[model samples]
Target: MPADADIRERLEAKAFELGFDQFGITEAATSEQIVAGFRKFVELKRYASMEWMAERIHQREHPQNLWPEAKSVIMLAVNYGPKDDPRLLLDKKDRANISVYARGKDYHDLVKKRLKAFARWIVPEFNCDLKVFVDTAPVPEKPLAAAAGLGWQGKHTNMVSPEFGSWVFLGAIYTDMELPADNPHRDQCGSCSACIAACPTDAFPQPYELDAARCISYLTIEHKGPIPEEFRKPMGNRIYGCDDCLAACPWNKFAQASSEAAFHARVELNAPELGDLVGLDDKSFREVFSGSPIKRIGRDRFVRNVLYAIGNSANKAYLPQVRTLLADDAEEVVDAAQWALEELS
Candidate 1:
């Protein structure tokens, strides 16, 4: 049997073998800083339409609250860096710019499977129980990740790794073993404000803060109604999630492009024509996005996003596509279609 220190070292080695780009360990404890920040975030309504965040505040405030027996947390990061600069697609006004992360297989499924495999190996070898989590859990992934020395949270409030930059997907494994914790990472974002300046919607009120209500990702993915007219033009051709902040990080200078085929962009998803996307009805939408993360928002919300993109497109070519949805049963879709037609006209 190996010593606890040896187990810690081997666990990290096994994590890299399992495809996680980075790994670190931290004791599972109540995080008052996380609680204070979350309270303020919810108090200010910064979570936008994500009422679930407010509902799960208690569980998020402390890791032990979620699982009492959890003695340590193993935070892992997987790089999903794009083969080409994701921002280059913005210049193609007639095409929709799906965020790089969403262009591949659903990360929740991929990361969770990898984590479960690691957890399965851990249980038998270490004789300890564990639980794995991706984004779906109420875990404070970023703070715990930073605490585990994976990376410091950047001005964009996303973890920025020295190796993977902002292109890393985070997951966690909580175990009963009291593993040695890695030294916490310190804030390395100094003087530079590229992420703040890159916001198309002025989503950042200040460095390290976000108003999700005005975030393009929130409007396109979470907000389930007619997009406020104010954001339509700034949204540009981005029909799914926005990547401006992530793409603007200077730390990406050290980032390596992801080699995972599972994270590579699907040809059909890369810069898809707005005309093609605007025509997707319910059946076709499901068919096209069958295994993609975009499917979760449903056809109505997706068409709504595309209509906003078409409105901002300044190309008359998509006017007919917008017109086709003028009588859509989803009131928000009809509203967006009308708005897009008026803008294009």
Candidate 2:
């Protein structure tokens, strides 16, 4: 077996070669701070309808609890920072605003493939068992990454890296081999409130805290049923996830666009016409968003989101699109259309 320092050095080199922008090592133990914060978020019902956070609290709070044999966690970051500002799309109300992360190939697939590649190379050399995770697993990714010194959890509650800003996708490899852990990062977001002020829905109830129930990302994506009337106007043209808080981060000045081709924005998804997207039936929806993460929500939820954007657009041209969905089989879609029609009227 290789020395811990030697393996750590080679692992980082391999990670970068595999297109990961940052790499760090941390012990597979959860911090009390992370557990406390998560419990508070859950206790407040801020996790919204995602009850799974509470369900898998133990696994999410403790990395060792997740995998007893795991001794080290290799935290990695892949920069998906947009070539141009994602916020620019917000002004074009006729055009739908897909978040920067979703405008390209799904990072879950892209990041996981690279993570497995790195794991394959390391496992044989170090003679250790390993497991990998992207976002789907109940992993304490941000807190673990911060503990690994890859970044610090910003006031926006997203991990903010000095080099990648908040636009990086995180993944982890849990290995039984012991690795030298990196020094934990200290908070770098001193006296800055830009991210807090950028929220259209006022999602931040306090600094460094978020009410996910009120988040545009949650409302348009994870949330089922019609969005509350109070949040619809603030949802604006963001038919998918919202990036205002991420874009508002001052650390982003150091962020360069991702070099990975797979992460680059797709032209069609960029500023897509609300009218065009709203017209997508189940078949066409699958065809258009075939490999994109947006496809997961299916046509019903997606069309519902587009209708809300149309209503907020104040552009009567999309009224016909809204009308066509008035009788959608999905109750949420019909409710969204009716609400949109009323808003537009």
lDDT of 1 by residue, 231-302 (tens): 999999999999999999999998888999988888889989888888888999999998899999999999
lDDT of 2 by residue, 215-251 (tens): 9999899999888999998888999999999999999
Query: For model 2, what is the alpha-carbon lDDT of residue 121?
Result: 92
Lowest summed lDDT window (length 10), candidate 1: 29-38
Query: What TM-score do all the candidates reach, one by one?
Result: 0.98, 0.98
In order, what is each prediction's RMSD in angstroms?
1.0, 1.0
Model 1, which residues run further than 4 Å from truth? Answer: none
Clashing pairs in 2: none
lDDT of 2 at 256: 92
Single out the weakest 10-residue window by summed lDDT for candidate 2: 1-10
**Residue 199 CA error for candidate 1 (Å)?**
0.5
Candidate 2 regions off by >4 Å? none
Q: What TM-score does structure 1 among the candidates reach?
A: 0.98
